[model samples]
Target: MAKTIQCTVVTPERKALDQTVDFVVLPLYDGEIGIAPDHAPLIGRLGYGEMRLRRGAEVSRFYVDGGFVQVVGNHITVLTAQAVPADDIDREAAQQQLDAARGQPASTDEQRQIRDRTVAQARGRLRVARQAHP
Candidate 1:
């Protein structure tokens, strides 16, 4: 059997997952990174995208808007500003949010920031959906 690493995914609201996983694919700001047990110690800034975790023959998917990943020894932890399981996301609601953000006027700095984040989250949600079905 392949060596496994302790993986944890967390957001401010809750701890999403904690398990021994064979491998993980994360969307860093630069690109996608594949990690496994005993991987070289590293840390990365994540972008809006999908995170894939594999354990044996099972795979789990999550959507992350943005965050950071830390790797040390046999442990990999992902801390994200926003995240949700792909299966738990509501596609229709996501689409509505995307549309609403797009329709809003570029009036204030705060509003623009929110709009940008909403778009990023929508894209991440879309990526997770595509990856989950593929």
Candidate 2:
């Protein structure tokens, strides 16, 4: 049998997931990172993108909003603003969000930052929505 790590994903409302996984791939603020059993403990800033967990031949994917992750021994806990099943996202809605974000007036620094964040979130949603499992 493969070694597994306990993974838990949490949002403000509730615990979204709790499972044992052989491997996990998470989107960090700067890039993507994969975690295996016994990985060195650390913390990372999460990004708004796909989060994948695999156990044997099964893979589960979710879209995670930006937050933080904590790794300790054989456990990984994700504290995200939102953790949504990838298959639940709507492609058309995501696309519309992206378009609206792009068209938003970014005349001030604050406005530009908001627009950029929205754009990134929309893009992430669209990407996940497009590749959702059937």
* Highest-scoring model, TM-score: 2
TM-score of 1: 0.85
lDDT of each: 0.85, 0.94
List pairs with backbone clashes in candidate 2.
none
**For every model in order, what is the number of clashing pairs?**
0, 0
Q: Name the regions of candidate 1 deviating beyond 4 angstroms.
A: 107-111
lDDT of 2 by residue, 90-131 (tens): 888989999999999999999999999999999888888887
Residue 69 in candidate 1, Cα distance off native in Å: 0.6
Q: lDDT tens digits, residues 28-87, model 1?
A: 988899998899999899988888889889998889878999999999999998777888
lDDT of 2 at 15: 99
For residue 123, model 2's alpha carbon misses the true position, in angstroms, by: 0.7
TM-score of 2: 0.96
